[model samples]
Target: MFYRYGRGDEPDLQPTKNWIRRVLLYGAYLDGTRYYYSPDVFLFFFSRLLEENPDSDIHQDTVPLPREHIQKRINADGDAMELAIRILACYSLGIRHKIDLTKQLSLQQEDGGWEIGYLCRTGKTGSRLVNRGYTIALAVNAVGALLTTRALSRNGILIDEGFVESNA
Candidate 1:
């Protein structure tokens, strides 16, 4: 799907084309491990592909979520990491969102890490656990998104230069 779209060719299955395109373009998928859904992974891979194929038109046009759908998602207080990914995805695809970026920033914990609740299950009883790596990755990506869109500076949010360099 990624190659076909980069080549400006559509897949034969029209019905599944959108799904495949989204998965390749956004790295979004259901029922996957937390790592699989990381926005950093999506942005990194997508940007790499674009760099490798400068002539590709994949970035020329993008499929954005419906305005209503995006608004609904933004209004809901769902997973912070997931919401950050959605926000970044919309921003990247040139979708305009009226939602305040501060809401996302507010999700940051006092410990300087974003919570990514229940990244995995452990033990035979299946107790949910938080993964430090996942939390750090999510926080880094969320902040990266804010920086990419210039929201941090525009909103007068000051981040430590060292932190940004290390994460970035």
Candidate 2:
């Protein structure tokens, strides 16, 4: 996509914040894991970015300006879930990139969240911490992770008591 639209000044089509988050999530999970083509390159660059920009905000009123001098590396067949998780992690840890890469992998509300895709693929094997299935077990896990991170980064509560209190 970048190559066809590789103009140096081309404007990004989607929200920049989400892209930043997804790229970092992809990098973290790609690390130490074998990919179809080769190892993911962002593992190193993002590591350095995290190392150098430790003060980046996890939650605030404004998005942080990205540094102009980021290094690019090439790799193929990267893990998508890793990318989703890392975006969440960066958002939690304070990179503040806005793209919910998970949303891309997840089934749309129109699809009822049951169909299969890379997002539906299981990461678990041989008694891993996470499970492997398209069952509610998996869906709940993913939603739980997203909600947990979101709560941690902002509201700090899973369920809003105000809504429950008002209903009662």
Candidate 3:
């Protein structure tokens, strides 16, 4: 299906941002069999490298999956909160894929600090861990990524940690 993109042939066009997110979040990791986490790293790079193309017609020839197809990719029993969490996970992964670690770092909520796998599991109320639930490890990882990106962007000069913290 993707081969048609480079051939200059217009295939069916479908633009579903949520599905795109899911493909990047889940399908990218699938090895024609099962899913894995390695795709997260790949996605991080992919998203970071995305250009702001006003004239690009990449999606114009893309085939969009049906809602049922997207529905099957979900594993949280169709719960709205679960779906939201997955989408957030996709954003986190997508930002990383784009290699815009700064964006990933900024995605943190003001309520809680950084941690790894902050929203991986449910808490006391069968709800996923929220930012304010407590300081999780995933948040720390995300924050660290932010710090590193800032330092790099500043050309090895140390940025104000306080400034970074407040911005978060």
> Model 3: per-residue lDDT, tens digit, 50-153?
32221234333222322222233333232222223333343332222222333444455565543333223333344434353333444454455555655665
Model 2 per-residue lDDT tens digits across residues 1-168 = 232344312455335535646545444343343221222223333443454444443112122322211112211223433344344334333333323334434433464443332332223432223223333333444355555555654665544331111110
> What's model 3's overall lDDT?
0.36
TM-score of each: 0.46, 0.27, 0.25
Error of 2 at 85 (Å): 3.6
Q: Candidate 2: list runs displaced more than 4 Å.
A: 1-34, 37-83, 88-96, 105-111, 119-143, 151-168
How many collisions between residues are there in candidate 3?
Answer: 20
Sort order, lDDT high to low:
1, 3, 2
Q: Which sections of candidate 3 miss by over 4 Å?
A: 1-135, 156-168
Candidate 1 TM-score, true structure as reference: 0.46
For each candidate in turn, give its C-alpha RMSD to the true structure in angstroms.
9.2, 15.2, 12.9
Q: Which one is best on lDDT? A: 1
> Residue 34 deviation, candidate 3, in Å?
21
Greater TM-score among 1 and 3 belongs to: 1
List clash counts for every candidate, in order: 0, 10, 20
Model 2, residue pairs in steric clash: 17-97, 17-98, 17-99, 18-98, 18-99, 25-83, 25-86, 25-87, 26-83, 58-94
